[model samples]
Target: MTKKMTWNEMSPSQQTGVLVTGSIQLALAATAWIDLAKRPAERVNGPKALWAAIIGINFVGPIAWFIWGRRR
Candidate 1:
């Protein structure tokens, strides 16, 4: 079986990478949420409340919104 390394056991670079990835995810989610909030109800493909909940979901939620929620 493979040994699992705890956070304290990870190398500095590995930890940095994890932190950076997490930060990016947060940023993307925030941006998507803000954009959704600023959009008028008529411009969104779905209901504003539904999009708000969807955007709260981790990485995939924001991506889905950008891809499917916004009207062309």
Candidate 2:
């Protein structure tokens, strides 16, 4: 079985990397959510409510919204 390391057990570099990655994901999700909110309902490919639900899904959700939610 693999052991899990707590935050205190992680190296500084590892902790920094984790923080950076978490920040990026948060930014991506936030940007996607804001864009989804600001976009007019008629211009979106589907219902705004549906897209809102999707944007809350985490990294994959926001990426999917950018890839498929917006109308070209």
Candidate 3:
């Protein structure tokens, strides 16, 4: 089995890739949450509360929200 690497054990490029990917995920989630907050109940395809929770998931959640959550 492969061993897990800690943050300190990762190389600079690997670290940078992780950071960048994490930043993108956070941004997408934040944008989805913000849209949910500002949008009306009727404007959203599903329950806002459900979307709120789903937004916490990684890239998939936010992308799903953007693609299928909104009425538009």
Give me the candidate number with maximum TM-score. 3
Q: Give the worst 10-residue stretch by lDDT in candidate 2.
A: 52-61
lDDT of 2: 0.91
TM-scores, one per candidate: 0.84, 0.88, 0.95
Cα RMSD to the true fold for all candidates: 1.9, 1.2, 0.7
* TM-score (C-alpha) between model 2 and the true structure: 0.88
Clashing pairs in 2: none
lDDT of each: 0.91, 0.91, 0.94
| Best first by lDDT, ranked | 3, 2, 1
The RMSD (Cα, Å) of candidate 1 is 1.9
Q: Write candidate 1's Cα lDDT for 1-72 as tens digits.
A: 999989999999999999999998899889998999888889899798998898888899999999999986
Q: Against the correct fold, how does model 1 do in TM-score? A: 0.84
What's model 3's lDDT at 38?
100
**lDDT, residue 60, candidate 3:** 90
lDDT digits (tens) for residues 1-72 of candidate 3: 999999999999999999999999999999999999999999999799999998898899999999999997
Supply the global lDDT for candidate 3.
Answer: 0.94
Off by over 4 Å in 2: none
